[model samples]
Target: MAKALPEFAPLSLKELRSLWKKYRGNEDIERLVLEVQFSRGVINEVDDYFKIIHRTWRQENLGELIAIEKLRLVLVKQHLRQTVLAEIKPAPKGTKPSEPPEPEPALVD
Candidate 1:
């Protein structure tokens, strides 16, 4: 039987821009964005997007990067699927201990 591929909901343009802002200085995320640009043959569009961001200091230019091209959007969503899920996943809900655990007593021979 063929292995089932995981399904990821498509990310909206807004979400992609938000991700760019949230992880702006992360090298890994920046690399992923470049990979998506190359993989989708949208290098020029992505470059122009970066220029706009550089000029205005606005992260929302990331949205414009994929907005003009549907294929770019699809490629970006696929590349960033894992990152998006990780960022938006809820934190585990549990109470913390009131006090730190005491260090184990030192063993003496």
Candidate 2:
């Protein structure tokens, strides 16, 4: 019998953006995000999942639980990107609001 594939649910765009804001400065979180985004299959294996979290924390010299939380945020962002893209609507022609673009982070420093 073929193994049943696990269902994967991506996070909402809002949630992903929030997580990015919260953890953008952490190198461990950055690494974890890359891993989760590129990993094959649904991430349903607990041991493998935790191992990634553990490795990231140890390599980055972060506290254990905090590292796990950061890794979770990465996963959330990956999921969000996948699921949220479909829901985003293009701005209507001429009717779109003309808000100023977000300022570059470097300009704020």
Candidate 3:
């Protein structure tokens, strides 16, 4: 007999909804929102944060650039995860139904 693979439990819609609501009103939420709106092309927040840290490091020599880089990587990953979750969560109850899906692309002759 073949062994069974481990079962994976996906998060409930309610839990995802709650998580989405918890972060929606936060000022930091705006960063993720901007990222999604811009289709991940913009990096203003990340660039600004790095610039400030770089300036501080230059003046104080308090930490190495590698340390700052590590921190920035962690923050960027977190922002991406939150943005994806927010996008996936369903809209609130009583809202109008969403529009129909976009038409499929046509093949070129």
TM-score of each: 0.30, 0.27, 0.29
- Please report how far candidate 1 places residue 106 from its true position, in Å: 59
Candidate 1: deviation at residue 78, Å? 10
Cα lDDT for residue 36, model 2?
A: 45
Against the true structure, candidate 1 reaches a TM-score of 0.30
Q: Which digits, one per residue and each the tens of the lDDT, describe model 1 over residues 1-109? A: 9998787574543455566677888989867654543443343344345444444534455444344456446545644553364343311335122322232222111
* Candidate 3 per-residue C-alpha lDDT over 16-88 given as tens digits, one digit per residue, 9 for 90 to 100: 3454467766767645444343432234344445656667787996766787878778666644543454333
1-105, model 2: which lDDT tens digit per residue? 999878655543344445566788887865654454334124323324555657766899875586576766766564454546424232233531233222223
Per-model lDDT? 0.46, 0.48, 0.48
- Please give the lDDT score for candidate 3: 0.48
Q: Comparing 2 and 3 by TM-score, which wins? A: 3
User: For model 2, what is the alpha-carbon lDDT of residue 59?
Assistant: 92
In candidate 1, stretches whose alpha carbon ends up further than 4 angstroms from where it belongs are 1-4, 37-109
lDDT of 1 at 36: 43
**Top candidate (TM-score):** 1
- How far residue 108's Cα lies from its native spot in candidate 2, in Å, is 13
